[model samples]
Target: MLPIALVVAMCLGAQASLFLALTSSQDRMALAGEHELASTALREEQDSLLRLLKDYAFWDSAYQRLSLRLDTAFADENLGLYLAPAHGLDYSFVLDGQDRTIYATRGTAKTTQTALTALGAPVVRAVSAVRRIGPGGDPRVVGFTLVEGHLALFGVSAILPSPDSKMRERPGPRALMILVDYVDAGMMHELANRYRLADLRLTGARPGSSANLPVTLYGGEVAGHLTWSPYQPGTNARHQLLPWMLAVGLVVIFLAIVAVRMGRASARELIASEAKARHLAHHDTLTLLPNRRAFMERLKLREESEQAGILYLDLDGFKEVNDVFGHGAGDALLKAATERLQSIVSWRGILARIGGDEFAVLITGPLAREGAECLAQAVVQAFDEPFETAGHNLSVGTSIGVVFDNGDLSGEEMVRRADIAMYVAKSEGKHRYRAYDPSMERGRELTKQLESDLHRAIGTDQIYVLFQPVVNAGDGRTIGVEALARWRHPDRGEISPDIFIPIAEKSGLIVALGRQILREACQHTRSTGLDLAVNLSPAQFWNDNLFEDITSILEETEFPTHRLELEITENYLLRRPEAAAQVLNRLRRIGIRVALDDFGTGYASVAYLKRFKMDKLKLDRSFVERIANDSEAASVASAMIALGQALNLNIAAEGVETEDQARALRIAGCTHLQGWLFGRPQASSTLMAEIPLSRRA
Candidate 1:
């Protein structure tokens, strides 16, 4: 009995020590993870604030209103009321080139202070730092500072023109925009909720007994400390096991063997849980694929001297599918896509779902480039077949961008270049792959410039309407005019519609630009008494306010609805046939005639022609251009014109550059001819003057 008692005592002590050690180790890991999470959350908040500030500071409209024009109304509308509660911003200020405060807002109210006197030297210091960077440099400063004895996050940026603005060349001291948000109780509460911490708060001084993280400025000055109740996983576990432990101690000899087995089982479960947690951290839950962090880490592991190939893929039309169907269907589609990609990339590369509808492939070692290209092609072809999900056959494609490491690029840069190439592929057309080239970077910069400039062009004189006469076939008399949008870029001269139109569409500027063009066209031709035809972009047509905006524009310009015609392409109609039918019916109800522009370019069947109730069909330029040169083209064009006539739709042949083409189309039952043959697209004033001449000719 003495020997058993001694053995039991030793065993119990050893087990207690082992269990305490395990729990302590787990607690330490949990604490370390919590600390990292807290730090990351703070950094992310700063980044978000900086991004928000840059968004307003580097805007053309903000520059124009605050720096160039000094429009206070604009300041009050945007920098004042808009930035307050919506963004959790506590203070907003705009300073001129001379360091004079031109605008100031405290919360949602405009302040009379012409200077940031309340903010003291911190504002001046931040502004000076930003100015030191200058317009050519980073031109932004963001940090934490104490404002009126309270901790706050602040961002200061030089109010410079957008990347595409011509004003970038203007010589002067640039203005500055300042935004501030306080680190108040609400923010602390939010952090607590996010990180699952307790009693999170900011303290001017370090607390004697609490888990605290120091908030440091850019200059390494400790402004304050964030205090939180640290999670004590070990203590909690010890408490939970204490009752059972006491019971085991009471029957030590009897339950010794049972307790050992249970201890082993518990240890296994804890290890398994830890393994699962690690996997969850690095993988996407939906597809069980490696996530963005895992992908980046793996890419970073490649040697700088090693050659590698990276492929960035973005799923096309996934958002539309997700919207029209449901997330369940989208998830199923993604899973199926993952399987297909896995098959193509089997044993060749690492595949990861970086984000929503975006995936990345990394290939290294010999023949990496060749393998990547083949994999990309296979991936593109794999998506050609419709995916079966949620009782629906969903058709979607992928645009892949492939880049090979030149032994000089970093992993992040390789990924960036691959992403850019993918965007280029999607822009040119989806369902294709593009190899990265040096020129693509330049093209991307130019595209960014264009997107920025295009925003300023709308509602300004830079964007205007050009009228191209639609002449009656056989007689050469101008019966109607089509309004085309033209952009006269300040520096680049005449920017083609083909270039900027797609940019506008891609950037979601199409709806506004389309409305502007429509209003301008109606206003320009309100006195011409000729039929006015305007084109509608897919974005404009799908806009919820399309009918309202169009009718409002017509009413504002006093343009007759019966004489106004809106042209839509067949591709858009084909995508959403039911929705298109409904929108078309709405447009026709308002007595607006809708024409099918660029007809015969796509697979528009007779059923679509009758179903869509189009008033006119504009024969595609490709068909019209080839009609006079090719026999088959002529037969096809003639058949299209006859089909239009049979459907009681006016047939307009576009791109009629030669008399032969015009005569061919006229003989083939074309009612209207529009192209360089009759009249090139001209300014509204110039076209109005030539209207009588066109009638007489």
Candidate 2:
């Protein structure tokens, strides 16, 4: 009987020990889950705040009124009043390019105090960090800060123009918009309830008895601690099991069995959670499509099959949809686009969203190239119908680049080639697909080299401005000279403007190049008494500092603004009619002349011509070349000139090579004629030398 009792006691003790160990393990797992949940909740809150700030900051109206114009009324009406009670924001501030507060709001009321004054050095640090990152950075920041000794969450974002804005690519200083939310009783209670955290509160120091999360500031300084009562399942379970253990030894055996089942259930839950995390990591959150990582992984694992193909696609005019509508609409459009792509791709390919408005497809098996082309064509056709999203019918197109594996290339190389082709397709014109070619790669390399060279050539003698004489239509005498940029490559000889000019524009080097050309032309013609015409790229024209840059150049060269004629294309005018009108009016106010160049090539209508109020209309060369042979072309050219004449605008015919074309233009009421016939684009020195002789003629 004694031996049996001792054995029974040993069994009971072992059961109790096993029970305690299992409960303790479960408790640790529970605590880990709670910590992760709390961390994720904090991160989610930060992301939500950032999204709100982005919605406001990346807007045309916000950029224009707050950053560009600093309209206080607009800020109060649109931004300030919407904060506080509506959005639960404590304060909102708009800082100018110089980090000075241009607008501020406390709750729903406008405040005189700046972000720096209200929030202290933290605001300055955040702004400085964002500026340091510049255009390449995330452009938005969210972090914690101690405002008035209270823990607060803040988000700072650069005031950037919407994707559809004409000033999207125009480089300049950016204003910052800041939104602050304080951690008060109500916010703590909401967080506690949302995260299932008990007694969650912000404290100045870490609590010994509670689970604490450090509230880090923008610069990584620990501002405060968020403490919460930890739920200990192990301790609770042990207390409940202790009474059973003391009452009956058999209860320990039953509790141990229960604990074993609970442990197995917890293990299964953990495995499922891990699987969910993996799925999320591999898939896009919006479309649930395999993301870039998954696509690349599959690509790398692809067999060396001759029939494999890749297609890279980019959405054309999607930015306009985002800018005009909103991000919500943009997201809906993306999902719609994904659905359309999936319908086309079906089971033939693996589709993934690689970047913003960019997608990739991988296909294998027989006739992969043909299949890719078919898929590409279908994808392009799918977007032909406008997508109805957010109660708005938005039209967007896609450019696709297709590549077939040669069995020698890696997956990354194939994707890269496809990307290059896609860009080429976009450059040629959107809503089309281009197959990857060996020559295209060579051309891409050459373009990169040229872009690098062009950067170094600006403001140097390697890049010089040449002048093409604009002659009187009847007498053929030089009246004004239009400045044309020319580049003399050191090794490759003279690089055509047709090649380098586009490169400069694409690289944002056109701003500096345009300025240099303007200065040189003004300096050369300051004493020549010749009206100076200089073409402004869409980039240079839309530059925020355009007026100031032009004024400074004119002043530095002592060139009269009245004698300056800036030529803009029809394309630029169609981009933002209202904004272009304002810019044109401002130029006219300062005694500068604006001309509509390459007329009749774009979507400029009669109303646009009248509304823009330009000084001249330059007929595109297509009309001139066709006018000599095609009577229909001559009539159109004549009518265009007649319209310009009725508007009291000068009509300049460009690319006049023959006397017949010249006579046709002259009879059609063209005031100015420019072509090789008048003398091809020459150096400023050549024009200067001919000035006296031209005057003699």
Candidate 3:
């Protein structure tokens, strides 16, 4: 018994010693990681400055202006007060061919204009080093510098003379230099916050401190040091160490008890975390409903259950909500919709937000089919009341498809069939419900095939453009042509734009389609001198670089922008009015004519007419068709024409299929006309020869 007691005592001492050693090693490793992280952050900042310098130095404009040595105005406009503050740069310098500073500005505000004579010795050294490397060689020179009592990271690069020999008529050597922000107390604190280090500061070297990283400048000179120390407890060292000593003593007294409790607690925590993860994986976060995975699981579990029905529901016009009111509003609308749906489903039905605006429900009971249909009707009725989301009173409709279990169908099969029915309900008319029918499968197959073929068509040379002539109402002479994109599926023949345009929009292919159409139109009409009008989709506006796209097309085709007219619908403006207005303003400034197409078909507020600069308004065919008989339609057409005249805007009557309709439109004071009467949409080659080139107002 005495020998056993002595061995146990020796084991406890050895274990305590091992714990202390491990704790010290962990502390050292943690400190090393913090120091390494700080150094990386500093190096990343240096890299960022080098990238900015390269972007400015390698540019064609910089090359031309710097080589000439006569463009101080270039520096004044770009490197003055705005550039430094906007880009978080400290100093901007444009050096001439002979490594002479042509323009230099320092500080965040450019208030301190830096001259070559006043340049700091450290900065001059960096510039001289980059010059020695020569322009058209290395792109960047990075180093630290001690300037104005602060250590700053400096980057310098030689500006390559333009590859266009025309710009280098007179030049020697050219380069650009920039001084990044200096590392001060505020910058050090910022770095500490980013790296989560404590009490980071610049300090003299500590011989054995692993937390010290050396800062080197040009010519391998030591600029300064970046150093940090470990975080300390708020209390005295004695108080901080007291708890640890007590813990060690307790560990020695109840070693087995402490180990058992810790192991159990860790096991319990791990079990709880894994359970939460599994629940989250199967549940929708937004609606707290079963997700697709969970829904499928439930369906599989209840496959043999009697009288089960699966109802698949999709919200119609949901995309419009996202496009018009934004994704936040869409989310809010979905949440509100789920609550309404929940009330109808109650506790008996399993409701899930499958994805997006789609929802699925699994119902079981003797009257499951009837209950499902009733619930679907209730959902349809619920949407009749407008949804108030973020001050936008939006309206949406639900199309539901219900499929009752036939005792043989799997859950996935039932859901797929129900989805097919839902699409059919949507196609027939939204805000309705339909029970799954086998006949619907054929149409679904066709849709899938069409989508697949469309993908193939887009990848190949199957899509083409045609032009439709817009003629004067009185003389029946073509004045302008509207370009129309057409798709000729190799096996299916000519596909209507109406049928494929929506597909393109849904598939996110509209932007590429619009770009191709624009390019084709510009190329076709470049020399024809006929005013060219191209319809622009609302989706096209989402491309923030659309202005650059138009500019590039014009430059490439050399098409006269003044003769190119872009027609957009009022819905496009309503979706994103400010963005549309900005785009229109840019287009108008560049000599492009903007026109409102399908004018009466959308939200026609005269306020939009006043806000947007439009060259013309094309009267929709609905009003034109009604003008032949409906007095109200005739009055609206006359009113629209008068409004256009009052605004000094051109009004064009479209879809004029009959002589009577054309006559009525002409009598109503519409200045221009387009449709079947004018000419069907045809190849540009055919229409170009028909319209004479010589015409003026």
Candidate 4:
């Protein structure tokens, strides 16, 4: 009994010692790993700094001063100011092959010079090695030996920030150089101060010693990865805190044993609880299918990664089902329909209630888009049968938007594209599926970005108007200025108008943009007293109170209404003739001019123009392009000019890109012609300052 008791005591003591030793070793290892990470960070910073230096031109006075050995103004004032910020023990020296300090910073002990000596080791070997490598050589460690008379030590890579576009001047590389020591705590602090976390110690096994100890790292280049260290923790270090480690180890062992025993039971309980809660959260009370949130989440996840299928199924004539059968009967029918859907998909796909009488099925993994469409067809076919609910037979129809995943799209973007396709399907007269087009995706990005920019356009103060002068065709005199929107993005630089205009229109932000432009044009006219012409889209007619907005802007700016002309395409009249006529009439009533643009390209119904008063007719560029080479086109232009004459409209032939084309237009009796021939769009002020060339006038 005494022997057994003694054996049990001995085993416990051995286990406790082993546990404490292991804990202490782990702590030291952790510290080493942290220090290693710092080294890597410094290395990365150095690489970035090198890139900056190579990309930009930089000149440093320090090297020149050291070479000349001159204690001059540039060295004293500029070089001193540059090096002063470094504030480290590092001293700059002119290295000569003869091993002499031609010029050394204030701290050179007489005994510091020696062959392969620690102090001279970095100065001699580092500089010589770096100079041999030159640029594009290794970045590990570089220096120019005094043998070459130049080289500087770049501190740990982490101390460097991102490079600048242009280097105004070189402040030279900063280093906490201890030519004698490997690297001390003070140098570590200096580096860490310059670059965050550069001083943090890392846990690692020490080299050639069976004990973990603190290591001060000089730079990432020299750290050489402590991870490869072969030495392990000594026994004493591992077992330093025996009893405490034993307690922790024992508690961990007990918990791990219990966890293994009840693992399956715990997992089953957790899954069941989560499933029940999720079921309740996402399902409708009576039908017990998924709700809108589930549908949206599923749709979102599907679009962001995997290729999946979304069936936006809307029950056609479900309103009549409720009206005739009553709400209780309708509820029963819904439940029956949900049951049918469940039986078809089982746990394979998500069935969700979108809204009143609207349902969606989002399926993923091994589910084909074709298969989903087939299911939709089956659903339609099944619903053809009488759904008996509340002792009554009811029939309903459905229209589904079949959206197939393209890949890597946002949930909202997918839904929107699908919705658009679905609308087209519905317009074609419902009861079918439509595949989303990849072509739409190609055009969507720029449009979306433009829409975003336009929405934040006013607040970001990113939108600015650049005015181009409109010159008179008669005498080439500046007539008016046209304002165009320009985007100066913070990161992307300049974004063109061609990219964003359509986007703004699609997002309905065009209305706001147009209003802003109108206000700007009016204000500019008031300021410069220049006549201005602005373009308007067909969508502008939607604003029933546009005339009111225009009048208010004119009043505020106190700009003459006669000086502001608005131009819209001939297609605008074809879009909504009645609305366009009313808007034109209102503008005319306000003493403002309206120009019919892109004429002879649309439904050029001469009778249509008589419906509302127009001040000018802009010949479509296509017609103008053809007139230069074709007599037939010349006749058409002649006819259009004649029509404008009889209608008392100012005829403008656009796209006169040559002197001959301008001459022909003027000969054809066109009063105004705008083209590159008459000086391409110049800044408003430049136009104001130019003297017009006399020709047609």
Candidate 3 lDDT at 268 equals 55
1-697, model 3: which lDDT tens digit per residue? 6677677667666655544444454455455555556666676567667666655665555665554454665565556654566565666766665656667777534434453444467667777776677434675777777666677767777775333211232344555656566677877897777565677888645436666777877667776778777532212222334355446754554654443344344445444544544555566667778888789988888746577888899988887777666778889989888888888888759999887789998988888888888887887888788777677777788999999974678887898889878878886767899998888877656655766677667745688888888877777767788899899988889888877786666554677788888988899878776788998886686566688888898899999889999888877787768867888998899899988988875555788899996899999888988898899999999998999999999999888888988899889899898888778999988887766655312
User: lDDT of model 3 at residue 350?
Assistant: 92
The digit string of per-residue lDDT tens for model 2 on 142-219 reads: 888878888889989998766322344246778899999998888889878866779988888777854778888877
The runs of at least 3 residues in candidate 4 whose Cα sits more than 4 Å from the true structure, single-residue gaps closed, are: 1-446, 459-461, 527-530, 691-697
Which ten contiguous residues of candidate 3 have the minimum total lDDT?
Answer: 231-240
How well does each candidate superpose onto the true structure, as a TM-score?
0.61, 0.56, 0.49, 0.38
lDDT of 1 by residue, 82-111 (tens): 789668899998888888888888898988
The TM-score obtained by model 3 is: 0.49
Better of 3 and 4 by TM-score: 3
Report the candidate with higher TM-score, 2 versus 3.
2
User: Could you report the Cα RMSD, in angstroms, for every candidate shown?
Assistant: 8.9, 11.1, 15.6, 24.4
Worst 10 residues of 4 by lDDT: 156-165
Return the candidate ranking by TM-score, descending: 1, 2, 3, 4
Summarize candidate 4's per-residue lDDT along 553-616 as a digit string, tens digits: 8888888998888988766665456767877887888789988888886544678888766898
- How many residue pairs of model 3 clash at the backbone? 1
* lDDT measured at residue 311 in model 2 versus the true structure, 0 to 100: 91
lDDT of 4: 0.56
The best-first sequence of candidates by lDDT reads 2, 1, 3, 4
lDDT values for all models: 0.82, 0.82, 0.73, 0.56
